[model samples]
Target: MRAVITTEAGGPEVLTLDDVPTPEPKPGQLLIAVVAAGVNRADILQRQGHYPPPPGESDIIGLEVSGYVSAIGAGVTGWRVGERCVALLAGGGYAEYVAVNAGQVTRPPEGIDLVEAAGILEVAATVVSNLDAVRFKAGETFLVHGGTGGIGMFAIQYAKARGATVLTTAGTPEKLDLCRTLGADTALDYHDDWVDGVKEATGGRGVDVILDNMGAKYLTPNVRSLARLGRLVVIGLQGGVKGELNLNTLLGKCATVTATSLRFRPADEKAAIVSRVSDEVWPLIASGRIAIAHQTRFPVDDVRAAHQQLTGGNHVGKVVLTF
Candidate 1:
């Protein structure tokens, strides 16, 4: 089997495809013959040495994949060899084969191409878990940053599908338009005072939930953009980690702040999220309530170019690697 390995902590150039031993399924896991893999922002972090794989997990840098179940580990049932499936992972997705926990695997909704399904689960699971934490409800207004990115695109449509009035921020006009097309009620320019735009969009009452990937760079404003009792879930730290906040304002609004990494979660917890996604979100997708976000695919051998495409920040949706 061939897999991508980072030669050192550095740029996309550090990633190289090389022959590696194919893994056998551990207890309660499944060995998947990879069809395609999702490339994500976290992959860049790992490639640059900013993020390391969790202890005892594969050092490979992918968080989701679509593949066929080639074998099942002991104690796993309800799965058969040769069934097409997808999975959320702690690591080890960028390869010809990956071993994932059976509890974390899902069959993609029928009728969608198995290859395009690769990029959907990781972002869907991320959005669903964060929104579920916030208790986001119908009729509430939701705001997400980077609305044209993988997570952002899905977040926009998923929130709308659940009946929330959606708001988003993007750096380019075309990107902002796509956000609106995906169901955002308002699209603000990230290059401008986006918080002010949020205020204007909501008529100053603020939003009920915020899905922020910018971390410290948007922390204060995200707080300022919340309505009373609002929740802010930070799922990325593309911005610097350290930030200042006004305790007085947070208290006044009765708002809460949380940060989570799907890749760092315990297996049982990830299994639960994956279950929710398969049972709930997948239906929405199957019924056409939630549309598939756009995607760009590259052959697995072009791993460096895939990383460059993601880091370049111009790709409209999920960047994927085809086996």
Candidate 2:
């Protein structure tokens, strides 16, 4: 099997396609013949030595994949060889084959091809998990930062589908238009006073739920932009790690803040999330209420190019690597 191997932690140039032993399924796992893999910011961070794979997981740099089951290990039932499925992986997706726990595999939504399905699991799981944690309800206002990215785009569609009035922030006009087309009620320029814009869009009540990716950079402003009893869910730290919080403001608004990550969770927890997404979110996808957006596809051998595209920050949605 040929896999993307990093010679050292640095730039995209370090990623090279090399022959490696094909992974075999372990108990209760499935060996998938990789068809396509989703490129994520986590992969770039891993390549730069900022993020490493979780303990006991593969060192390869991918978090989600779509493919066919080539084999299944003991204790795995109800799934067969040749079944088309997508998986939320902890690692090892940048390869010709990957071994994943059977519980993490899900059937692609009806009418979606395997290549596009590669981008579904990670974004869907991330958005759904955070929204569930915040107890996001219909008829509330939802705001998502980085609205043009994979998770951001899906978050907009998901929130709208659930009956929330959605607002999003993007750096470019093209991205803002795309967000509106995807159902965001308002799209604000991230480089401007987005906090003020969010409040205005919500009729000065502020947003009830916020899906934030810019951690420390937006912490204070995020607090300011929340309505009473609002919830802020932080999932990325592109801005920075440490920031001061205004306890007084939070108390006044009765707001809550939560930070979460999906890759390092326990197996059973990941299984639960995967199961919920398959059951609840898949139907939304099948009905076309939520859609998969693919900005570009690069061959597996050109993994470096894929990484570059993601880091360049110009792509509107997911950058997929095809086998």
lDDT by residue (192-238, candidate 2, tens digit) is 99888987888889999999988999999999999999999999999
Worst 10 residues of 2 by lDDT: 287-296
What is the RMSD of candidate 1? 0.9
TM-score of each: 0.98, 0.98
> Which residue pairs in candidate 2 have backbone atoms (N, alpha carbon, C) closer than 3 angstroms, thus clashing?
none
TM-score of 1: 0.98
Clashing pairs in 1: none
